[model samples]
Target: MADLDAFLRDLAAESADLEALVADLPPQDWTRPTPAEGWTIAHQIGHLTWTDEVATLAAADARTGGTTFADLLTEAAPRVTTFVDEAAAEAAGAPAPELLRRWRHGRTELADTLRAVPGDAKVPWFGPPMRPGSMATARLMETWAHGQDVADALGVHRVPTDRLRSIAHIGVRTRDFAYTVRGLPVPGEEFRVELRAPSGELWTWGPADASEQVTGPVLDFCLLVTQRRHPDDLTLRATGESAAQWLNIAQAFAGPPGAGRKPGRAG
Candidate 1:
């Protein structure tokens, strides 16, 4: 496993990168449709902020042993929905500068909260309870995925980094999420992933002798798992039937099953 501190730092960095991208968009741009059906850039950012707030509450609940983490999330869902909807509506008529300002505030709050939590602290998540470190990684996955949607709406490309580790962690750990969403049994065999990082180093996870292989640049792997880009959009290659199939439906974030948007749709 990667160092917990390093993982949290990466998550914060990615969140900062995303904030910079949306900092100066035009007012209308915030309302422009994203690849996510019926969601705008504001909606996406709002979703991130909403979830982070829920995470903070869950973390607090875990610390107190007030209730099971699962129960906390169940209670948080309705609140999350209301927050996103209200935030989206509030941002709908705001000017670009105000919208960006609000977004920056929310992002900073989330990032700061994550940093303040102890590494070993467990929190309620969509899946099983996760340590603060893993939860931070999961937040990174969400930011990158939604950041891609925002970039696509503006006809921009984001050159992601070696953050494939976070995406891969979500990919493998959320295997049951994929299976449950598709109404299939989770496969027993692990899949090996070899991706070239932005720093020109190779990052490998899972056993080398695993039955399935997913090899490509780290950016593509991240994009694929996030459902930001189609598998064919990059040079990702899968060697086994299970690997190939997983690639087609990979999703790192929690929610409903993502059938994956078409390639051109993101552009």
Candidate 2:
């Protein structure tokens, strides 16, 4: 329970930080292009808003034995490869104030709905089902990742916070998913991940005796896993061939493999 509270609080803080970045932007700035190809600042927020609303529906459906989310996906599948992009583009058409309002409202609703989920009950998602706490952590990761795109568009350098620990955790946990999604063999050996956190603490994962290792700054690891920064632009060091290749294709988000940033596109 305490952990869930902490995750929820961190999720809220992450959202608030991103909101602060764009809340006061001039209307014209909302249309500014972000690093995401063909997506503007408005599209970024819109994507977050749409995902949050869908998450809220999934949580509500789980809590009530409804199949709204499953049905929607089934109906859209085999023909709607671009449903996510379509949803974001549709939401981006709203005026800035309206878009902001919808985003704020949708996130609040999602947080509240997640809190109301019964203990240990899983919520359906685009990927695997997750407990409320895990759901909140994924939300935080996405918020931070998309916030990076927005920050790049605005040329703002966000101060890295310990909240990044959640993203790093996801990055490490999703190692096998990163491989399996690409039709590649999942490595049998565990990879040791040692990242120096912003507060100068060492965040370690996997067994200390693991043969394969990845060592780097936590921010760089997070950016690499999120596909926000190209591998060449990060300072992460991989000690094994598989581990080295993983860096090139790592993605924390669920979907098909992401078209990660090009080399030298650090933002």
Candidate 3:
């Protein structure tokens, strides 16, 4: 059974972990451009902060259905690329300290809201509502993903943690959705995925003997699915054509297909 309390605890840990590195940045570093296109470190934090507020609102409301997060962006701006540009533009002018203040307070409130919501209650989101457990997991995944951009800007190495198990699990579960978002047909057959978790334990999903398979370090798989790193840059192996193809364009988050990092060009 999914432990909502455990999930919330981990989610808080992720938030705190990222905030530590960000809290001490020198003033100029706030405007440093990260690997994520057109996003300074401040913009990345701003985006996360903005999304956090929306998530908190969704959690408190049971009538959660409307434009998905991606669609919400599209509706506000013509291209997904520009969706966050406007917000980032305005935020860039704020003092870096203020930005951090907003994010810190917002995330704490979001976590509190998650803890108060009943486990089985649906929370409205960009798309269909997610149960509290799923909502918490999704928040953790996004935090880690965006945190990667922050880490890169600072040129700091982040050690893999067992919390990645949740992220990798979501990646595996969303394999078909990865293809679907791109309007590609999901492979008819199942593909097994085996991961070596950070703690040296094997975390297996799908079938062990399936013809199509993906096997690699949990860290690599998580980065691939989050579209933070191109599959070619990782040590992951794909056994069949379907699996190989899936690796090329895998995306775990909801949205239009992300223009993932390019081979030999990841920032």
Candidate 4:
């Protein structure tokens, strides 16, 4: 079971680590394009800020049982891509220091809001309302995913750590989502997944002897699912056709299918 407090603590730690990386970036680096094509570091932070605010609203709706929240999400659904493009453009225009400040404050408030929700409550989201624990884990996953883009853009190497267990956990949990997003029936057979964490502890999900399985370093698995690293670049090995097919289109985040990192693309 997921613990709200533990997830929140991981969120804070990840946020701080990314902030450290962003804080010292040279001015030129701020405007440098990250791996996310056309998006500079400014746009990355800006996007995170915009998303943090949007997520806060979702949590607030969940808290108060606001009647119109779903309607608003529905209306916003069709234009989600447009909204992101617009937000990125607008964010790019802001000064880097201001952008960082907004993101810092927004994420803190989001953590506080989630802490108040009952552990069992399903919070409103773009896909479905999620329990507070799942919601916190989702936030942590997003932070790590976006942070990868920033790190890649600046040519910084992030040291892998056990913190990735949060992301790996989300990735493993979202195995079914990867198929559903593409209108495919989720395979009924659960694949045994074994991951070697940064701390060198073995992490296993599902049964020990499932016919299908995925085995690899936890960092690589997280990168694969977050769409940050192409399958070819990682050491992940998948047994069985279903597991192989999943690695090709695995998306840890919600919404539609993502345009994952291209094969042989430099990051």
Candidate 5:
């Protein structure tokens, strides 16, 4: 079982870190365009805020035996062609201060509600249902990924921290899902992944003696998996054809294939 408390704590830390980045920005700076096409720094934070609200609703519903989360999705499905972008765009229209306040409150509510959720409860999401621990990790992964966009837009270089382990973990865990969603056959054999963390500790996944392997610095791997950096811009090495192919399509987020950053875009 996951250490739920630990995950929640890390999620809080991640949110605080991102919040610090934008909290002091002039209101006009929120309109700065990020790497994501047509998305401003406000859009990045807006997306995170909107997602936190949705997750809070899901966790609360699971705890109280309510179906508002599912019902809302069912109702929105037909009317919204791309709900994620729509939500972000709508939230982005808010004044920067108001948007920041909403994000802060929404994330806090989500963390509190997830704590009250039963240990085995599955929370409804855009993809499969997730346990509280998985939900926290997912939130952290996104907070970091989108935070990267904000950081890049501001030309800020954030030092890698151990919190990235959550993103890296999800990147490895979702390997098969990456393949399946891309309409490609999942690799038959396990592929080894070995990443060296910022603290100089090694974090590894998959079986020993695996024929295919990926090895690199943890930061580069996380950037690759999150599609924040083009493959050519990363130092990750793939020892087999399967591993190489996996690198091309790797995505830590749960969604359709992402339009990864173009080469030379990494800062």
Candidate 6:
């Protein structure tokens, strides 16, 4: 696991980078359709902001001694889903500046809270009680993933950095999230992942002797796992059945299976 302080800093930086890209968009662009079906840029950002609030509540619940982390997620799932729906509806026609302000404010609060939380503090997630560090990393993964959709829709590109370590961590650990989503037993074997970061450095995880391997550029791998970019659209190369199959349903963040966009639809 990554050092908690470093991970939180990376998460905060990535969120700021993503927000900067959309903060000055024209009002028309805010309403432009994204690769996500029936969702615009506003919807994507609103979803991120909404979930940040949920994280806050989950963290609070964990500290107060009310419910198990799993139970907290189970109870809050429907409410968060509904909140995202209502937020998207409300922001559908809001001005670009107002939408940007709201996103920034929400994300700022989330980052601050994440940094303040102790590393070992457990927080409610879809499956287990994640440490504060792990949860912060998960949030970073979501921001980067959704930011990809917004960037793709706007014809911009994000040069992902080594900070992607946080995302890579979640992607590897959440292999079970993929299995659970498909109603399958979690694979017993680990797989090796070898990726080239945007800065051209290599990042690897899992046992080297494992029968599976996922290799590719860091950004492409992130995009693929997040379901923001289809694996077929990127340079990801999976060797072995388990690795390939895992790639098909990889999701680092918490949530039900997203209605993943089809290949070539966004391009």
What is each predicted model's overall lDDT from 0 to 1?
0.74, 0.92, 0.84, 0.86, 0.92, 0.76
lDDT of 3: 0.84
Q: Which digits, one per residue and each the tens of the lDDT, describe model 4 over residues 139-223?
A: 8888888899988887879998788998898898899999999999999999899999898899999999899999999999999
Which TM-score value belongs to model 2? 0.98
Task: Judge candidate 4 against the unseen true structure and give its global Cα lDDT, from 0 to 1.
Answer: 0.86
Relative to the true structure, candidate 1 reaches a TM of: 0.84
Q: CA lDDT of 122 in candidate 1?
A: 72
Which residue segments of model 4 deviate by more than 4 Å? 67-75
Clashing pairs in 5: none
Instruction: Please list the residue runs of candidate 6 whose C-alpha ends up more than 4 Å from where it truly belongs after superposition.
Output: 64-83, 91-93
> lDDT tens string, model 3, 191-254?
9999999899999988778999999999999999998998879999999999999998888888
**Stretches of candidate 1 above 4 Å error?**
1-4, 66-102, 115-120, 265-267
**What clash count goes with each model?**
0, 0, 2, 0, 0, 0
Best model number under TM-score: 2
Clashing pairs in model 4, backbone N/Cα/C closer than 3 A:
none
RMSD of 2: 1.0
10 residues in a row with least lDDT, candidate 1: 81-90
For model 4, where is the 10-residue window of minimal lDDT?
64-73
What would the TM-score be for candidate 5 when compared with the true structure?
0.97
* TM-score of candidate 4 to 2 decimals: 0.94
